[model samples]
Target: MTEEKGSMLQSVIHPTAIIDPQAKIGPNVKIGPYAVIGPNVTIGEGTEIMSHVTIDGWTTIGEYCRFFPCASIGSEPQDLKFTGEKSFVIIGDRSIFREYVTVSRATGEGEETRIGNDCLFQASTHIAHNCIVGNNVIMSNCAGLAGHVIVEDRVVIGGIAGVHQFVKLGRNCMIGGLAKVVQDIPPFVIADGQPARCVGLNSVGLSRAGVSEEVRRELKKAFRLLYRSGLNLRQAIAEMEQELDSSEEVEHFLRFLRNADRGICRGTKE
Candidate 1:
């Protein structure tokens, strides 16, 4: 057990719980039976760690979060070369880690694994180390993240999807269940299949989200250049640059495509 020195440690711990005296627990927090809070753990105000859960080292969780039964957070990265570096898991407020969800600590020394606010991780989901997860994301049951993946805001990942390491899923993207996501998924699209392909734009989603019609038209045109024109990527991007004026949404899409380390999912099969 490490030393705890903070305004935390003022929280309520169940009598049945085994929290290290060294762990820093915040105000109005609850710890359930047989829950083990290891050293260097800092749980924020109004959070709850349920029964049989284990929160390990160097973990920092924000306020109003909930961890269900058997959820394991801040465990060491599963990467083979990890020699117990001082990696951290930083979680923001109002997030839910459901039953059996496991979020590993960072893989690089002194590096941080980050999860933004209002995200939901359903049962048995695994977020590997060094992953950057943005706000309002929902990952369904049995969805797993490999090391260093980046998931942008407002994305909904379907059940049992396996995201490849370093793959990035752009904002507002939807992936179908059981898909093997080996490439990057750009923003505002629906991707599905064994090897994922961009099936169509997420029109219904955008409509429900209250996106403007003009923006939708711009996105539609952009999509046409990228997916429907049959032009190669460079040619398509060049054409889009020539034809479409810069808008925030278009710029985001272009930047996503430009910065793709793992290539974007194609509209058609090879």
Candidate 2:
């Protein structure tokens, strides 16, 4: 197996493009027609800069990533109170930013906006400044994350979902399409609604990811205690502790629920 190499920078750059001589571009980095790479930009090896894309000040892009047409990265944050802060946008390796996606630079002085590796942002997705995204995450078309939101690893945010500011979505969680998530979503569950409610365990996702059946069984019981039973929040927690067998996954779920500052979603209505 030969090592996969990308298109060379000089060979791939279009003659009509404008790139700053001070920009740091690595080997096998492709810049498409009419693209713009600013002086403060540093593009890593094997990254492809597609047509009409603009990568501006203080942006660092890792290797082997692809940016689709018209993706505007490293633009100033949308915060009105911003006073030209010295901020940056950092994108990790192997991520894909689709057409028309917008990832803003960090909001405050000396801060940074971060995106993790191997994630996919579909067309028209917007990640606001100061947002933190984790690895292997998927943000569907038109999905948006407000400023300071935290999206954990392996999470799938459905199309057209609008996540409120300061919300934290836990690992392996799934948000249904068109949902408005204004609260913190716990790990390993499905959240869906106009205001987003916890429907149930993410069975399809968990099974596809090779989670054990025994673990799924325990999760089901925990869901029943927390959602189905008439017990209040504290009572539900107590019941889960006493009735279900303890496991790391279960404990993590409980801890997430307990720490929800914005509150958790409601379970499915019977």
Candidate 3:
């Protein structure tokens, strides 16, 4: 049910919810029992903030999103260098934050902790300061990402996985359960183990995403060249360029390799 409070048409807010008067709440939004919305927060239409969810700071949540019970968004950064600078947590549409998930705001002034559309952050997942999470990403239960981490589109982080600070997880990469990611992961790769070694191409994920078989074959060839061929990094890249026909997938892989400042994750053999 909805209510009209004076001139403003208020959305359905439970009686126990504490929403600051300065907060901008769109139509059809639902603030559940005991949920707290801070002054500078803006929740878009059709979003639901469940019981005991706390959304504070300068957070902006998009339409059709859901925050489960006890989820904490726009919380202060854990970094010691954060000195109350103005930062934001921006979430895109159709994302779901499961129970106890925590997303912290950025540390630097005017920076943002951004999450793209259609992402699912499972229970107890933690996204640290200044992280950029791309569309359709899934973080399983208890996954944790440190400050400045970048998770690209369609990536799946397994349960209890821990990604270190400043690491870049490339598109369609699958990180195994309990993996410790300390380096950059290139696109379409399956990484697992303690230090997260690249096992092989993410064939299942590619197939599920409707990637053409021809592209998969080329990626497999590139993977073999990079991991199995005993050649050095430069040699492998050169071989891939010379042997493989140019395609979007090949270009993306090469570009990721070229720009990886923290170094790419190596295979078990390497």
Which candidate has the highest TM-score of all? 3
lDDT per residue for candidate 2 within 206-268, as digits (tens), equals 888777888889988888887789777778888888888888878888888788888766777
Per-model root-mean-square deviation over C-alphas: 2.9, 3.6, 1.3
All candidates' lDDT scores?
0.89, 0.88, 0.94
Kindly list the per-residue Cα lDDT of model 3 for residues 162-257, writing each as its tens digit. 999999999999999999999999999999999999999999999998889999999999999989999887888999999998889889998888
Model 2 steric clash pairs: none
Q: For each predicted model, how many residue pairs clash, with residues at least 3 apart or on different chains?
A: 0, 0, 0
Question: Per-residue lDDT for 1-270 in model 1, tens only?
Answer: 222235545566667788787888888787888899997999889998889999997999999999999999999889998998898999999999999999999987899889999999999999999999999999999999999999998999999999999999988889999989999998889999889889888888778767778888888888888898988878878887888877787788888988889888988633
TM-score of each: 0.94, 0.91, 0.97
Model 3, runs deviating above 4 Å:
1-10
lDDT of 3: 0.94
Q: Give the TM-score of candidate 2.
A: 0.91
Compute the lDDT of residue 197 as modeled in candidate 3.
99
After superposing candidate 1 on the true structure, give the runs of residues whose Cα lies further than 4 Å from its correct spot.
Answer: 1-10
- On the 0 to 100 scale, the lDDT of residue 190 in model 3 is 98
